[model samples]
Target: METTFKNKVALVTGGASGIGRATALAFAKKGAKVAVVDWMENDEMVNLIKELGSEAIFIKCDVSKIDDVKAMVAQIIAAFGRLDYAFNNAGIEGASAATQDCSEENWDKTIGVNLKGVWLCMKYEIPEILKQGKGAIVNCASVAGMIGFAGLPAYVASKHGIVGLTKTTALECATQGIRVNVVCPGVIQTPMIDRLTGKTKEGIERFKGFEPIGRFGLPEEIANAVVWMCSDEASFVTGHVMAVDGGFTAQ
Candidate 1:
């Protein structure tokens, strides 16, 4: 068809790698001007964007900081004229520890990046989208958001809070032409998981057990779902927590 998202302007946080990176590329491929935001520098990804012959620009950002998020959004509108879509995908895979053992620092960092970061991004993103009179937003949640998981208290709590925020925000903007949604990914094949499991065969299989599909998800797989949610194809969809967990939540 007409290449969905053509001429759109999209901003993706955590865009240097994983699902964020894939979503940025996907949007660019569909003819959207992409703004890639992440704190880390990934030259290979930066070069790849240039190689794709698509309009993509990288901005180093730490979403946990509200001021940074505000400045980033301002820069996006200044450069792109208006923001049509945003993937508030910046988050941290926090320290895995039982609720009793989780330290204050770890808890603060986890909530700051995972929950507050999403809030900060939305805080600034919504106003701009409202100005445009239409926009789509997708926040990255986890299967853990839907249920409890031992030894991951902070991460679980943060993700769960994101789901709640997504629903509330969606309703508040439903009549204003803004659609907000959350994507709950299962064990995705990303560096964050690699760090958690050492990237070994046994490590990979261990995480796969959480999903009924018996495999970890690919970043591109998650990106594909995000693209659909943010496009007109899902016009009737809003405030949904779509689980990209390979049936993890189905069981």
Candidate 2:
């Protein structure tokens, strides 16, 4: 495997599962120390990283809260001594409903975790990366961010907000040795999608039909794009909203 990231440090929020987990492992496989932050415990993931010959720590955090994000960064620095890369991937898909029928609570919850959470992660993570003299940050967005998805106003809005936030932040930090970008994923095969689609065969097939590829994307597919964004291979790339959507957005 490529050790382009040897001796680097990477932080992945929502690292308990799905794209977050896959990206964390990718960082580990590339010889980077990893800090996996999520609301859930993921001992198995941490252990797997260790088995890959990289050090890893699982930090429990609810990305929506300011204090949690602050403490999460502090803990990462304490454990690894520096931060070089960050994947602000923690998010939620709120209850699906039309704008007129969506509940206020759902809107708050979705924006809280998906949009505010990314801002908070960057707020703390950027400083640490600056201290290290250079770093890269990839925020998790969705195809919903780039286009309208009926019945998902809150999710779509939050994702669109992330893209805007990422672009603005990238401009602010462009000369500061920190790169910020966003990945707009299509219908990925993650538990989140499963839950959103009710976990039924019909639901799964319907969701797959939305992707022109005739299948749902794997978390590893998104992980590969994320790791590349954080790697030197993308040194000249920043403020980019890359879509890994199997042509979902192209149509």
Candidate 3:
């Protein structure tokens, strides 16, 4: 066997850490040329990609900046000749505060990175994919996108917007060779979550127990879902938000 992504090229935003990093490595292992884009630079990830003996580039980018996003995609096209897949996984966990207590800056930051970033990425990336005559895009939304979370108003709103965009984009590209979908992950054990939820052992355990699975998700688990959505294995799947939340939304 050949991997579904063999010979393909993929761009993963937030690829320096956590889920995005895991996904990039997964794609590279499957023989896809991977572009790892993130605001933070990680030498370990870069070294790991190099160790795989696959073509991988680490691009420092603030996904919320339109110019940065454009430049990043341009670099990918220059490197790979065409973009076959994109994981719009760059986003922030906004301040956990009530709507009334949330600052305007919080709102702007969350929407800029989570919503506008995704929009700008697709706006620039779609053309490249169209040029290629076939491509796939998987946006990272959240369970918060599907339901309201009281303390995280900004994050909730941005995620919901992501889901809406995912649906409409998929519909627009249904007749085209491009496929678009969203993945909604819930309570994953990521550095962001660790920082936002608290670092104390007990606090971490409490947070993990919130998920029905009795444990938070691993980055590789979410990466698996993303790779599948980007692969031809999901050729017929589009406009759907597949939840990988350990049944967090089932209830």
Candidate 4:
């Protein structure tokens, strides 16, 4: 069978590591020309995409900034001629603290990158997708978005904003053939998680018990859901918050 993304172009913010890296590779494997966008350099990921027999480019961008986001989209279109898919996955897990104890700096930083970042990306990306006449966009929210999590007020608030943003964008673009959706991932095994848990065996186990599945989710698993959302199989699906949380939210 032919690959679903053959000859298409896909952009992934935060494509340097973790779920972003996994999703970028997945898009390439399905025959999409991939643009790996992140604040960090990802020469290794670019090489890996070439090894997958697909074209790839690395664009350094801090998605929270309007100038950076606009330039990022311009570069992608300049390189690939058209954009068919996008994953706005650049984000940070801010300082863990109670709402009252959370510093304004942490709140601003978290909301800036996680919520404003997604909005900035969509602001530029949607017009491009409209140029194509049809396309898909997926923003990375979190299980924290669906439910409240103590000691993470800023992070939780930003993710909740993303869910609302996704829904509104979906409705705005639905009739125009553009689809917008958000993915809510549980505790996925990624560098960010390592930062959160210190990569210790006990720390890992503690997070594992948070989910009914008895284990942390893998980045590739979330990648699978992301690719599927951008595929024709999900053509009828938009404005949905699909959780790839391995029963975390099912509780």
Ranking by lDDT: 4, 2, 3, 1
Candidate 1: give the clashing pairs. Answer: none
TM-score of each: 0.96, 0.98, 0.96, 0.98
lDDT of 1 by residue, 1-251 (tens): 35477668999999998999999998888878888999987666657766777677778888898788889998898888889899989888788888999999999999999999999999998999888889899999999889888998999999999999999999999999999999999989998999988888888788888878888899999999999999888889999999998888899
Better of 2 and 3 by lDDT: 2
Error of 3 at 196 (Å): 2.3
Query: How much does candidate 2 score in TM-score?
Result: 0.98
**Global lDDT of each candidate:** 0.89, 0.94, 0.90, 0.94
Go through the candidates in order and give the clash count of each: 0, 0, 0, 0
lDDT of 3 at 242: 95
Off by over 4 Å in 4: 1-3
Lowest-lDDT window of 10 residues in candidate 1?
Answer: 41-50
* Every candidate's CA RMSD: 1.3, 1.1, 1.3, 1.0
Report the Cα lDDT for residue 145, model 4: 97
What lDDT tens digits, residue by residue, belong to model 2 across residues 117-175?
A: 99999999999999988889999999988999899999999999999999999999999
